[model samples]
Target: MAIIGILGTPYNTVERSPFWWNKVSYTRQSFIDVFQELGHTVIVLPVDKTENIKNYLPLVDKIVLTGGADVSPYLYGEEPHAQLGTTDPIRDRFELAAIKAALEANKPILGVCRGLQLLNVYFGGTLYQDLSLTSSQIKH
Candidate 1:
C-alpha cells in the first residue's frame, strides 16, 4: 500500500475559561476515507515548525497538498489585495519547503484547491487575489 502524506490547516479555539488554543487541523475526511478505500495508508502531517519534514519524506510514498487558506501574496512578490482572504504564512513556508524536498526526492504530488495554487506559485506563477477582480462574466 502506498503511504500518503496529507498537509493540514491551522485553526484556533477558545476554552470555556477564556484561554485560547491553537491547533493544526485536517478537516477533509473524504481524503482519508477515499485513500483508504483505494488501498492506501493516509498520514496527516500537522503544521510543525520544529520537525524536519525531510526526515518524514522517506516514510511516505506520495504527498497530498490538501485544500486550505489562500497562499501568501508575498511568496509571489505581490501585495495582498483588499478582497484577499486569510493566509497562513507559516503553513505556506512549510509546504513550500516540503514540496521542494519532495520534488528533489522524486515523490509524486497531488494538489487540491489552495494546494494547486501553491504549486503554481512555487513554479513561478501568480495568483489573482480575488476571482471577482477579473472582468470575466463567469463566477467562481
Candidate 2:
C-alpha cells in the first residue's frame, strides 16, 4: 500500500482542545477521505520544518496540496492587493519547499485551491484577474 501525504493548513483558534493546543494544522476530512476510499493510508504532511522536506518525501508515494488561506502575494513578487484575502506566510514557506522537494524527489503532487496557485507561481506564472478596475463591480 502507498502512503499519501496531504499538506495541512495551519491556523490559530481559541476554541476546542486545550488552551496550549490552539495552533492547529489540518485538512478537510472529505479531502483526505477520497484517498482512503481508494484504499490508501492518509497522513497529514508536515511542513513545519521545511528544511527537512526531502527527508519526508520518501515516506509518501504522492503529495496532496489542500485548500486554505490565500497565497501570499509577496511570494509572486507583487505588492499586496486590496482584493487579496488573509494568508499564512508560515504555511506558504513549508508548502513551497515541499513542492520543490516533491518534484526533485520524483514524487507526484496534486494541488487544490491556493495550492494550485502555488504550483502556477512556482513555474514563473502569475495569477490573472479577469476584471479590470473599471469593470470590477467591487469598490477599491
Candidate 3:
C-alpha cells in the first residue's frame, strides 16, 4: 500500500499574542480511517523536527505540507511586514528542510493555505499584504 506522509499543524492559542505553545502531530483518526478506506496508509510526520522528517521522508511516496503560521520572510530575503502574523522560525527551518528533501527526492508535495504560501516563498516568490487595499478595492 502507498503511504502518504501528512504534516501536522501546531496547537496555538488565540488569546495569547504570538503564541508558540505545545504542538501535537498525528494523522487524525478520521483521516487515517479515510485513507484506509481508500486502500492506502496515512503516515503522520511532526512538522517541528528536522530528524523525524529525515526518517519519514524515505518511507512515504508523497508529502503533505499542512497550513499553520507565517514563513519567516528572511527565508526569501525580506524583512517582516507590518501586517504579517505570528510565525515559527524553528518550524520554518524544519519544514524548509523537508521541502528541500522532498524536491531532491522527487516526491510529490501537497500544500494547503499557509503551506502554499511557504512553498511559494521557498520557490522565490512574494506575498501581498492587504489584498483589497493593494490590488483590489473590494470591501471587507
Candidate 4:
C-alpha cells in the first residue's frame, strides 16, 4: 500500500464559552476516503509541523496538496488584488518546500483546486487573482 501525505489548512474555532481556539485542520473527507478506498494509507500533515516534513518524506510514497486558501500574491511578485481573499504565508512556505522535497525525492505529487494553482505559481506561472476580473464569459 502506498503511503500518502496530505497537507492541512489552518482553522479557528469560536467557542461559546467566551474564548476561541485556533486549530490546524484538514476538512475534506474525500481525499482520505478515496485514497483509503484505493488501499493506500493517508497521513494528514499540519502546516505548523512543516519543520519536521523532511523526516516524514521517506516514509510517504506521495504528497497530496488538498484544496485550501489562495497562494499569497507576494510569492509571485505581485500585490494582492482588491478581489484577493486572505492568504496564508505559512501554508504557502510549507507547501512550496514540500513540493521541492517531493520532487527531489522522486515521489509523485497531486494537487486539487487551490493546490493546482499553487503548483503553477511555484513553477513561475501567474494566477488571475480573481477569475471574475478576467474577460472570459465563463464563471467559476
Model-by-model lDDT, in order? 0.86, 0.80, 0.76, 0.84
TM-score of 4: 0.90
lDDT of 3 by residue, 27-133 (tens): 45665687679898888887666866778798899877776677787877878778877788877888878889999999988887777888998899977643533
Tell me which of candidates 1 and 2 scores higher on TM-score.
Answer: 1
> To one decimal, what is the Cα RMSD in angstroms of model 4 from the true structure?
2.2
Clashing pairs in 1: none
Candidate number with greatest lDDT: 1
Query: Candidate 1: global Cα-lDDT?
Result: 0.86
Q: 1-140 in candidate 1: lDDT tens per residue?
A: 89999877766555753335646466589999999999999988877673578777788999999777899999999999999998988889888988998999999999999999999999999999899988888665
Minimal lDDT window, size 10, model 1: 16-25
Each candidate's root-mean-square deviation in Å?
Answer: 2.3, 3.6, 4.1, 2.2
Give candidate 1 regions above 4 Å deviation: 14-22
TM-scores for every predicted model: 0.90, 0.84, 0.76, 0.90
User: lDDT per residue, candidate 4, 1-140, as tens digits?
Assistant: 99998887667456853335656466478888999999999988877656677987887899898777788999888999999987888888888998988999999999888888999998999888888878998765
Worst 10 residues of 3 by lDDT: 19-28
Candidate 4 yields a Cα-based lDDT of 0.84
Q: Candidate 2: list runs displaced more than 4 Å.
A: 15-21, 128-140
